[model samples]
Target: MSNRAKLFGALSLGACLLWFRAAAEVPPETVGQVAELPPMAGAHWLWVPDRLFRHSILFDGDSGRMLGAIDSGVQITPKPPLWSHARKEIYNVDTIYSRGHRGERKDFVVIYDSRTLNVKGEVEVPPRAADTGTGIALVGLLDGDRFLVVLNQSPGTSVSVIDLENRRHVGEAQTAGCAGVFPAGPTRFGMLCGDGTALTVHLTENGELDRLARSKPFFDVIDDPVTEKGVRDGSTWWFASFEGLLYEVDFSGNAPAPKEPWPLFTENEIESGWRIGGAQHLAYHRKTKRLYSIVHEGGPGSHKDPGTEIWVYDVPSRNKIDTFSAPNLIAPFLGPQAGFDATGMLGSFLSFVLPNMGVHSLTVTQDERPLLFVRHSDLGAVGVLDALSGEHLRDIDEAGLSGALLVVP
Candidate 1:
């Protein structure tokens, strides 16, 4: 071979080897990449990433100035997979978590002063064999020394009495089978049972278990009226279940039960080509009493009714006022493992993280302003949305943070 030909052949072989290396680096079936991590902790009181793990958030209504972040700490299980943290919600407290001692098999509800962000004290739920933690999704700060802890989970699938003054163990009473507990009136509580039932319970002045009432919650569908449910303005209880049925259960029982639940936009009306589950996302305007529920459609490789639509229902009339498609609503696209890239706020007014798009935490502020905060699961971003204008507000990216968003009052 000529010297020039030999040199050219050597260079071509080198180039081919480099190309092979590059091609081998990428698997043919590879589609997604390891996304960047979410925001870290420590910043203005604005939104602490560590503050939301398996927790919840609630804005103090009376003051309306401070915000609360609650989370239950990590628990021990037969395996790490079985260990799950208790969901904490911010109300008049911060750092309120249910710490489970694996050795002792006990779950203690710890409350922290939001201002100091310090552990105020702890309240132990009724002692159990399995160390079932505080499954309290919704905790209402009624006044000083009293708060309502709703446990929708086992061991504590009832109401927990917490005495802030003493800051110690208190009594617990079995409400309905499931958690979904909300306050209806002073000393009275509302709970949605897992058995497609809603019951009202009255409490003693000193925070003792009182009586239970069977409510005639208005709904259109009798076969399955209870879909997904929540309490509105602490006065009316709303449930979305069985197709697009949306029903409002008045705690006062002043309103008559509806022959059927008002339809929030049927699946056919939306042309979603999917069965829409009733209980998607339920959030109520604190003062206005307007209720919002996300009517979602699930896609392939997704849970049944993965939530493709958001429905808004009027409390007074029990009617569907508006509906938005899932695609239009911002949400993170999940990879095969059901994860997404950690994309920060696209813009100040755009979504930072999409709502879990499946039974996520989405709530509008009590103020007249239409600001709404939604917790997106794919990326674990807390999304802020403009409810009135239906615009995407900035998002607070808090993936791998300390807690999960509970409720925002």
Candidate 2:
């Protein structure tokens, strides 16, 4: 063959080979569309609110995929969204400035369609709502989701009532020294006061204040205060004190009924310095009646310290069952199997190193097969574990740092 023909043939072959190589290396087509990750992901969705970012990010708990987020707003304390499966909507009370950080202030409650994740409607509220963060207790629903209760604070504590069915502000109730709005019954809600007592505010069907009832002082407000984090089972709200004591208060009656208080740990565990600690420490599963808490070995003034492990308790039996690890920075260095042993030599070394490596907030999904979702606040990462086994299954790295954990299910 001629030299020119041979050269042309070689060049053509090289071009074809390059094209095939490029085709093999190319990634799959990117789809810009949004689709649900798993079947009924909303049932097990994890809603994490980052107060610094002024928003809440939603994740498919089954697959740990980032679904979306809600822009809550800035300069105001974080307001966790209220999730209603029956209504197929998530309600968020937000106070947004006209500018990114400052300008005109507008306070309103927004309803988002859970399926479409879009704003359905909103109701303008008075500008006096509280700017202090209160986790999930800041917002509440009553009367089978007919009325919405929003706590207010401009130095004094009060609550603004909103008629959800009519989408209008109804009235305001003076709660005085009480902080959160805990729905007591069909019309009223309970609040923990500065004096360590509970005040139940009853409302008429039209959302008007009918009367007020108070409970006898049950906890010591100064010594061992009950954290604001409370989980309700039926008409009873379970609270844990800083010293690891449990309070079971029945709000079903006309007034709050405090049950016999008990300590979560035995004398030995107490001696080991085991106490509940974390931004959020209690996560209760209604079916199993199991309350999971973040526990750590620390002295006084460490109530807000990160937890080294999780301890599970059965509410009815009032007995400890399972315990799991939530190790800190050095735990990974000792290998994957090494847990945070607060009493051991390595654990003592970790205390001197980065003692803050542990779970910060936790929430458990209510389902036949339950899963515990824990957040490491300092790192803003999430750990998923089997509720029954306390086995660490996986971690969701995309969750934003420094936020409270909320599960829609």
lDDT of 2 by residue, 43-65 (tens): 56788877677788888777777
* Top model number, lDDT: 2
The local distance difference test score of model 1 is 0.45
The digit string of per-residue lDDT tens for model 1 on 83-183 reads: 00122222222221333323434455555544334455556664331222222234554423255453434555666666555565456777646455556
- List the candidates' TM-scores in order: 0.62, 0.83
Model-by-model lDDT, in order? Answer: 0.45, 0.75
Q: After superposition, which runs of candidate 2 have C-alpha atoms over 4 Å from their true positions?
A: 1-41, 75-77, 327-356
RMSD of each: 13.1, 13.3
Model 2 accuracy (lDDT, Cα): 0.75
